[model samples]
Target: MVLDKFNSVRMLNTDALQADFVIVGGGISGVCAAITAARQGLKVVLIQDRPVLGGNGSSEIRLWMLGATSHMGNNNRWAREGGVIDEIMVENTFRNPEGNPIIFDSVMLDKVVSEPNITLLLNTCVYEVKKSAGHKIESVRGFCSQNSTMYEVTAPLFCDASGDGVVGFLAGAPYRMGAESREEFGEKFAPAEDYGELLGHSLYFYTKDTGQPVKYVAPSYAMDVTKTVPRFRSFNAKEHGCKLWWVEYGGDLDTVHDTEQIKWELWKVIYGAWDYIKNSGKYPEAETMTLEWVGCIPGKRESRRFEGDYMLIQQDVIEQRHHEDAVSYGGWSIDLHPAAGVFGEESACNQWHSKGVYQIPYRCLYSRGIENLFFAGRIISVSHVAFGSTRVMATSAHSAQAVAVAAAMCLEENISPREVYSLGKVSELQKRLSRMGQYIPDMKIRDEENLVKKATLAASSEYHFKGFPADGEMQALDESVAQMIPLHKGDRLGKVKVGLFVSEETLLEVELRVSSKPFNHTPDVTLETKTVSLCQGKQQLELTFEAVMPEEQYVFLVFKKNPLVQLQYTKERITGVLSVFNTINEAVSNFGKQTPKEDIGIEEFEFWCPKRRPGGHNIAVQSEKDCYVFSVSNIDNGIDRPVQSPNAWVAELNDPAPALTVRWDSAVRIGKMSLFFDTDYDQPMETVQMTHPENQMPFCVEKYKIYDGEGRLVYEKTDNHQSINEFVFPEKLVTDEIKIVLEHPSDLIPAALFAVKCYE
Candidate 1:
């Protein structure tokens, strides 16, 4: 790929580009605005200064993307649809394998990237926006870092998504900073009089597991925090020490204007805390852990808010007043951190309101002067008292969505934002958002009964239950006991049912079972299969599985299996299955491995099983290169090893050219496995079962198979390819052992191998 010249100033001809809307900031709000406009078929240019898309929640800062619904105790309500936010979530799920940092960023990114009409320019900063005499933005001038060029971008509409309202400020848009007197907005929490004091900023950090001891050394300029503070406000005085408390150091510094000083102080405090930790030796096992994050950029809690058509106030928030122009809701309390100049405990306040939630008006999101300009995020027009509640990330995200929709409306009508509002286009905007899966509960037009019915049907269709009754009954029915049963999908109704088990206690014990077919297996893969049983006032069950190779094959588990209950297999990847269910049910499983298959060049394989108790069983198989052992057992521990192979193999070179092992145990049941050759690498390999005589253990084998690009089998073992050992073994086996090899015809690389398992 040819690289573009860096730092070379150049400007593209204006005739080559066209966009109906331009969104500055590239933060959550900007990205959402671009997505919403693009989805409406309006071309949009989204300019972000940072390389990464998310602003505060980006990996660089690592701030959590809190939404309005989040503070309201319903996190799902934020970013309800797969817009820019949802895309970020999906991407984060893939990028950040260990944690959900990237998930948050990717959710926002996905929306921007997936939109056909959105043009994203990262590493670009908009320094100036030119407006017409009528107070309408005509174009924006941004400097691109990659090309070192400044370009003038023109669009019919402009949006200010910068958390600080940088674009609005440059465009001479009216905006306010700091507190408004309580009298101005009738806000209960506002100060009696106006003041410039604002909430201080913070430098957040995160840590992970550390196996070894860690030590911290105080910085040279570290202050004696203990001497300068009042008595500690302990959450749990008896059990916890106030180490984290020492890290707090901000007081009297303007969060926005004096950010540099604030950052320096925070750094000193951090180093001091680390020093205290090391000297105190309280965290001995924290050596291997990482700081993960440090004070890179200070998170400003308060800044300049662009003045819009209407300013949302604390009165509206406390009263939960429903406004005709309301676009979003906030449930977080009026949590006003101490303004600059307060010290120690006096610097913070945590007063919270009861069940009530605040409704934010739409009029507070667009510019009061700039006709085509709109604002979202923390900069939305809200009084200090109301800003306390709406300032949370969740509320900001909802505000983004509202502004995006309003922008789209403006683009469609080719009118100013104020005109859109005056024409009562906000209701249509809300309706459009609702159709896109945004959770605007107030705008829901569907009846409660219809919504409930749809939800009920979806729940029933996707629900799956597995386990055995403790009483040894095949069937059990107890709504109360069954209430504990788990579902694979959807939110838990907090109601479950168990059939065939009965107990005097209100909560009955039951064991759940789950199983899955191999990914490359024949026919359609059975994602999960399990049987639950309840016994001895407790639940106990055993799951046994085996690989019956009809051809050269590959197989693996794709379901729950983890002792920590933190791991599970998706269709194409492994992930933590942690969700709302874990909190309610204390059940966990173990990780299991993929199934193994081999070439037999034979018609069939079988073995004899000696009957024993209905519990664990062990099976052994020997190949020309190794001996494989598998053990299947039933335990009441609820921990299933889903990712681990039940069988093990040690290769021995003197056996037959194509080795085969078959075993039978009541504890094990045969599932599916496949084999692939180089020719079928880009196609689906086929499965063919050869006839075999019945025995204590019954199974079949095939000679050859073909594979495809998607790991699917295309051609089955036929009479022409009757020999399993048709291919020559390489002179030197790269590894010491021989395992299942899947050859991709499209590539020169050798086949992939997997472990083998059989029924116990």
Candidate 2:
């Protein structure tokens, strides 16, 4: 080491690199975009200002990754966003079911590093953006604080996922900072001036018990929360981290430039809140508890929403409007917070949910003015009311996947983002995204290249609708419960028997209900009601409904709540069968039922949601006639998950060895085979702080073997727990027949598959 001369102006080391895509944020959206782009043969550079990836989802902030599933508090069934984000979430649940934030960090890091086409730069913040002619971004400049090095990254395309829109801001992209007026977009749910236009930033803290009393002293800057915060009494020792998402601030300030000030204010509130818990003598349970970790950076809810070709507005979300170029979907409620944050006297948030998932168009992904710039995450083009639904991590990540695929198409065709629409290539883009497991609502995969379409499919056995056997435990009728049954348009619900334990003679009321719309799961329309007389002890009660299904959809056979009655549950888990309860999950703002004010411009509906595994067993029922079918033709129905029907090929419960065969008139070369399994998409696989009962879905196939025309094993896998499994052969095989042998996760759960795709 040599001593530096005084006043010697030395330049920092500059490193230059080139890539196909430069994503300027390591949040879930950016991480997903990078992974998807890299997988599509694009060289990518992922830049993160923080020390780790996952942005708000990282350990530094610890916000749970949520989206369409909406905490299982709404009626959106099988609604988890898919693609790269799904893989990351599944991996997190398998490795860290305890939901430790640090372990989640490693999961994200591992996925990104595993891709050879990606170069990740952590602790590097992009500060400058260089633009070339024709409004295209030429390069970006970033500096790493830890290494004291500056990096100049050049790429054909750039993605601005930096929550605050740093690249878009410096690139002169049109954006909106606050909420838009109601007249501007016909948005009736627009916030008033008093409620504040912008959503705020929040900081979270975590606590734990040391098994001994711990003392805490307030700093000089710690404000007295008891005196300053109106909702101070709401704070307790039981909840921490994102559970206290309402513990927020900085909505009234410049969320971007004044972030440090907002962070300091949040710190003051957190410390003061802790001080009250310890010194105010209100929380005796907190005596042995101490602060384990507190977030230094705040999680921003909204910032600069940049402009795109078509801006998504309120009607797009509330009305579930269809888009021609639909590339993704969002199902989370329109959730907005007050500007005053924790200090506000009003309720922490106002959330309005839609009847079903709505499509997100591709036009809202790329910048309207900038040629090569793409917007990801909360900064995408959406009005304030629509943003309330699309701003969540999973939804944003889903949209980012659309951007990744669009970027790949752009590189392939050497065209601008707008040209993709002008040239009528959106369908091709959708097909590619669907192949990668990106869920686009109401859109089916129509790939002509899939060889399975030209072949005949047959299964060894198909499950017939009998009933769930009464072999599992029983639970009290503490809440209203219903069993979802699938029916054809003209089918009538016949006599059904349910096993129940009645304490005494009771008149149980059974009602048959269905959703007004075929796509919705909310049982809003009641068709028939039957009063069944039940005696004491365990007995079977027969119920018959004179109602015929209006369309091909799911109908709910509901049992009214009776405290003296208990219903028997079965261990069998199926792909599209679930028992939902009329209950409250306050985390997602589902308070049993939603009854909004007349002028709020929101819908009123009941929340019928499924419970997590190890508890969400199906109710025992018996029927003389078959009501549901699991045909082998469902494997090539284009639809992956269950929508109007089961959309899955399920084996019979007694099938010892379930197998599927595909045959052709002549041998054809096949290079790759993709199989879509049932991973219980209805449950929200929260990325952090939410423990799951099981790592692998009970309906998923655990092991499988594939054989060719010669009866030689081509590929086999065990210990599988992913929604999609792809096998690429090193040498293309010519086979007239292909057979797949499957193994169920357990005896109770049968082997099931959504779709099978083979390509040459």
User: How far is each candidate from the true structure, as Cα RMSD in Å?
Assistant: 20.1, 1.5
Q: So what's the TM-score on candidate 1? A: 0.55
Model 2 lDDT-worst window of ten:
621-630
lDDT of 2 at 409: 94
For candidate 1, write residues 120-140 as lDDT tens digits.
Answer: 888888887788878888898
- Model 2: per-residue lDDT, tens digit, 1-760? 7767785788999999999999999999999999999999999999999999999999999999999999998999999988999989988988988889999999999999999999999999999999998688999999999999999999999999999999999999989999998889888898878889888999999999999999898899888998999989888999898888999887778999999999999999999999998889999999999989989999999989999999998899878888879999999999999999988888899888988889999999999989999999999999988999999999999999989989999999999888787789899999999888887887777888889999999889998887778888888888999998878788887888878899998888889999988887989999998887888998878877778899988989899899889998888778888899998998888888998876666788898988877778889877766865578988888788888778889999789889999998899899988999998889788988888988877788989999998999999998899999988889998999999999977888899998888999
- Best by TM-score, which number? 2
Alpha-carbon runs more than 4 Å astray in model 1:
1-18, 69-98, 192-196, 208-210, 213-223, 228-252, 285-292, 340-343, 446-760
lDDT agreement of model 2 with the native: 0.90
